[model samples]
Target chain A: MTGVETLIAERSASATAVIPDIAHYLLNAGGKRIRPLITVAAARLCGYEGQGHLALAAAVEFIHTATLLHDDVVDDSALRRGKAPANQVWGNAQSVLVGDFLFARAFMLMVDAGSMRALHVLSRAAAVIAEGEVRQLAAARQIATTRDQYMDIIAAKTAALFAAAAQVSPILAGASPRVEAGLEIYGRELGLAFQLVDDALDYGGVAEALGKNTGDDFREGKITLPVALAMEAGGEAERSFWARTMGEGVQGPEDFDEAVARLKRHGALDATLEQARAHAARAVEALDAAPDNVWSQSLAALAEFVVERAY
Target chain B: MTGVETLIAERSASATAVIPDIAHYLLNAGGKRIRPLITVAAARLCGYEGQGHLALAAAVEFIHTATLLHDDVVDDSALRRGKAPANQVWGNAQSVLVGDFLFARAFMLMVDAGSMRALHVLSRAAAVIAEGEVRQLAAARQIATTRDQYMDIIAAKTAALFAAAAQVSPILAGASPRVEAGLEIYGRELGLAFQLVDDALDYGGVAEALGKNTGDDFREGKITLPVALAMEAGGEAERSFWARTMGEGVQGPEDFDEAVARLKRHGALDATLEQARAHAARAVEALDAAPDNVWSQSLAALAEFVVERAY
Candidate 1:
């Protein structure tokens, strides 16, 4: 993690002032650095003692940061990591360009890591993440989105990168195919649990705890897992409420409260949290391939931490 | 060029409809394949007889198309290549995301092209291009951008890709370092010439000839080369006019006409055109490292063609 921090500081330095200015703003915005932590943990679990994993961890964090920058612009987000987003501070144009610069920097770091196979995996993940974003955009106001469709969207958007991040370390370590595949599954399930908790938290958690406004998805007319499940379980009145709120993008002052109440009434948030725990359980199970070292144990506990915060 | 087109069509296809839709809209919008042409011509000049250059050419064009997509969004452009811009058709969010998707796809293609050095060149070029766009954003509407500063902007924004595109094919060919360096200079100088002519044409060329509205730079408050040169050569009245129109972005209906008139009186367009011719001459001279075969001669002729349209 120290090497990752050093690599990030060194690489984010650029000749153009605004490039580094906006980059450091986002990088210093109290981000948890969860993805890079996974990269390092997975690498150490595989006995990767060399410094190459540090570059890979930095690259993973770069990709995540770049996506956050672009996501803020695309979502027109007001706050990120509990602060005004880079787009708000620097303007959308600067944010977009800096995001692009960071993305290219990520690839450059991956190339420096000198593993062509890892490059292939991460690059493919980058493309798929964008595809998932586009898909999410298309599905934003569609309240009738199925559970499988929702899973597919999250799988492409979030889990793909986590899988790549965890898998790339094993590739760098020359670990066996089984270990690499198991870590990838560990990463994917952890990401799924993480996102499930996030979506559930959007309905049930406090705003201060979430670092973003609760009911943000509802305000944006996004049909997340809880909303989708609520829609499926509700009656005709519930359908119209959802149709007016999420589908038609019409919301009153009390609508977010009503939406949450209905989610509670239908046990939708509980259902979502239950699903997250199931995925977290699977994430822990996937760690069976790695030896029970301290790093592997920490990774297993991290999966529990990802979902437990929502409770 | 056929191979390039096929590669683009194939790579731009994605499961998400909007990604491919916007990608095809931009890629099929009558763009002249100038960058990829340079890729093929440079490969041929190095006497390379492999199919790998096709992938490299496709990667070069993907990078160009991705840049155009993002540039339109940053500029809030109405038209591109004589059609409504993709952002106008698909919204800025979609354009930005698709631009990212294409950028990732470009790197993937470079990885597939299988030269780490070329990947390095293209990735570095991508970062430089973004830096240039950011600098250009900072320079916009300032009314005091220096000629050298403007050169640096265009060199990064436009010429960096050309240089990489020309250099990569030789890397694939395993050509001598001298030939590779020569083509890089040729591409860089040719790109500078092309952009200079483009700026001059905004004030002098016809609407239909340039595929978009004339005086777009003036309306957008961009400090292009012609405007920078004109400001340097102008008096007090010209200064105030530019300050109001370009610096303050308070343009009246006739201000574009007046700006053109001032450009003519100051010989700015002619001066810009003269600069283009100088770069074109350098581009031709850079070809001395390669044998004077048909491919090399074609590249020299192409450089001349880049500047001739403005005259």
Candidate 2:
């Protein structure tokens, strides 16, 4: 098992049986344990040898999973990670209520960790995560979403948790301010790279390979990074195609294929990939101020691997 | 303006703008401002002369609005209080994020309330509320939902907030223990009564009078107190009716009317109303120990008004 996997495994039974069942269902469904892994890994890098990191790490995963569950319901998504979503199996009501349960359970677990700093990190992250979702909703299909707006959305929605996880671990480990800031930057950049790659994959991913439904974002009228860039670069032809395809009503499979082809023709995918790589490099750059350790090196490698991973 | 409206009338610009939007959306949408009023009235009974109750009262309203936003999205509810819901207007993504934002902003506001006691009451209530929602999810359409189980659900989902609203006022005002306990019980019983009335109203209320879609509970297949009692009273015929109706897609509108008629015949509404009245009485009973002030007398009258007005 991976280090993060072992940590999740060890602490999986801490909450009520019902909570663990949903948590296991979500975690085992597999979309990468990147954020919590960063938490544990960063703590290890800071020369911390305590097991409290395990609970805090699991708390981070629970928070992320809760957001995902709620997000899927909001998006009316039918598929995720190549499987029927929790809402599909259990219904939206269960999915949402369980998401709430997971959120509460995570905080309860953090309280057990007995660190005010941990609570602050997790609570503030919760607020930012919510703000990011709102930002994305407000930006949806507006065609006015600039690169800065996109960055802000990703920072709130995706990167905030990752940043909290990395920065928080050092705080838990009692590291100096300089080291904490470095870890925070590393996590934030990594999260940006991860989300950009996700946007790229959404436009171009093979469903079988990526374990997620391709083209659903376009169908739902979501204006992701690639689409945003394409809209910026596209001439009248591309612009009209976007307006018609994402406007409303039933979107045929052909429309999806055409949108994907348009994205490729505009070189939006390559540009998005370049952006992802830049964020990944920036993540590594942030790690430079940290003391050398195996966990630090692993986190840097993980940042690189996030962009490289097919799914 | 209602008493609560008068309270909201006096606030800062930003808070006034945002809060009234939520309050008007809710109060005009017509949720009995039972929770917040109980909060303000409780503070008054405890001899709290300051106007800080207005913010606390608004805090209670915000929490209630946030939950409704999440609940409607979870239920995919198209209608609420005889109108299109916030989710219907803004979409589920916006509703969910706004719900979260409300929750975060609530805590930020509470922090300014500056009493650790208030924080404990509200935070613990938040956790309990989440747990209650989960319990309701688990019990949905289940045949084995016991009355005790129902009580637990109501306590968490409804009473927890009411209890916090009432109890926190006393805590914030630095009331004695006996006074705090008295107000807590009053809120608890009142919440129980309020929820029972809601369950009954789902079957018994006039669409125009309640500003609610009639038979919503039945349509949603929720396992409310009335349905649970009726199910227990039901023979084989009624049991099968419940199985097909609650939580499942309806066969047609006529089928829905028939199911509601069956519920009425079974005296489910009466049983629930009687239970509600009993709780209202119990709530007033708890207030006997409170000092004979205008606030205390108003709260006593409010308890009686809950069961009576909800009917």
Candidate 3:
């Protein structure tokens, strides 16, 4: 963790005053460093005793931070992690540019890791994440977004990075192909579980714990699994309600309450949680081929922790 | 040239509907394919007869296109290459995301080029270009921006990719380090000349010839070398005018005419043109150690063409 902290500070440090300021501001804001933790844990599990994992972990964190900055702009959200988003503080243009700076920094760190395989994995993930974001944008406010489409979006936007973070370490450690594949699966499942929990929490979870309002996604017209499911089960009135509030961007103070009620009536939140738990189980199951060590044990526990956010 | 075109279309083709649509809209729009041409010409000059250069050329173009998409968003421009900016057509969110997709696609091509050296060169250039944009953003509308600072900005933002595009081919061809270094210098100076001509044209060139309107940089409050020079030469009244119009963003319709008058009165455009020619000469001179091939001759002519835009 200290290694990640050091390298992150060193890499994000820029001569352009605002680049590092905005980058470090969002980076230092509290969030679970789950992606980097996965990277480091995977490297440790793969018996990588060298210092290379530090840079790799930092690189993964940078990529995550970059995407978050860009996501805030795309979402037009004013806050992140209970603080003013970087875009709010520095404006959208600066946020976009700094996100780009962090992306470039991520690649620089990847190059430093000295693994072409890691570079390829992470670069491809970066692209997939962007595509996923665009896909989400296209699906925004659409009531008919299918469960499969939602899964695909989250897999590319979230799970791809997680999988890349986990898989690259095995490549660095020169582990077997089976080990690499197993860690990738574990990371991907864990990522899906984590995102699903976040989506469910948007309707019913505590605002303090969730770091933003309970219905941030709802306000943004994001068609998450809960909303997608509720639409599928709802009758004529419920479908129209979704269309007006989300699709037509006509919302009032009471709209969120109604949304939560509809979701609960349709068992949408619970169903989402159920899906997350299943993925969490699969995540733990993925470690069957990985080395059994302290890191692997923590990783298994981490998978459960991801789904527990729904509670 | 056809090879570059085919590869660009092939690589940017995405299953995600909007990604390729937006990318191709901008790619197919009429802008000279100068960057990709430089890449292919560099490869040909180095006697790289294989098919690898096609992908690399396409990759360089993607990087350029990606930056242009993001640049439009950052600059808040309404037009690109004589058409409505992609942000106007699909919105800023899509433009930013698609730019990211192109970047990822560029990296995928670099990986396919089968050279770590090429990957390192282009990836580093990508980072430098992003940093250059950020630097430009920080310096925007500042009358005190120095000529050296402007030179540094153009070198990083424009010339870095050009140099990288040229240098990469020799690496792919397994040519000598001396040849690689020469191509890099040639590309760097050529790019500098290209950007200087653009900066000068922003003050006085015809809009039809330039593809975008004249005074775009002025309208954006961009502190190019011409503006920097004119500011240095002007006295109290001119400085206050610039400060009020550019620095304070208090521009009227007549401000652009005034800006042009001040630039011409101070001979800033001519000075900028002189600097461009000097860089163009250097660009041609850089090929001293490179192979004396038809590609090299064409490259030298291309350098002249870049500066010729000033006339």
Question: Best candidate, TM-score-wise?
Answer: 1
- Tens-digit lDDT string for candidate 3 (A165-252): 8999999999999999999999999989989998998888587876766787888889999999998888788899999999988999
Separate DockQ for every predicted complex: 0.82, 0.28, 0.69
lDDT for B5 (candidate 1)? 82
Model 1, A49-155: lDDT tens digits are 88888888898999899989989888866468778888888888898899999898998998898888888899999999999999998898898898999999999
> Per-residue CA lDDT of candidate 2, range B1-311, in tens?
15456544332112213333433554467666778888888888788877666667766776787788888776655467777887777666666666665665555455445555675577667767876887776777675677888888898999999988999899888898998898899888888998898778777757777777776767666788877887889877777777777745445768767877877888988888899999989988888768888888898888888788665
Residue-level lDDT tens digits of model 3 in B236-293: 8778988888888889988899888889999999999999999999989999889898
Chain B, candidate 2: TM-score = 0.90
Best by lDDT: 1
TM-score of 3: 0.97
Better structure of 1 and 3 per DockQ? 1
- What iRMS does model 1 reach? 0.7
TM-score for every candidate vs. truth? 0.98, 0.80, 0.97
Model 3 lDDT vs. the true structure?
0.88
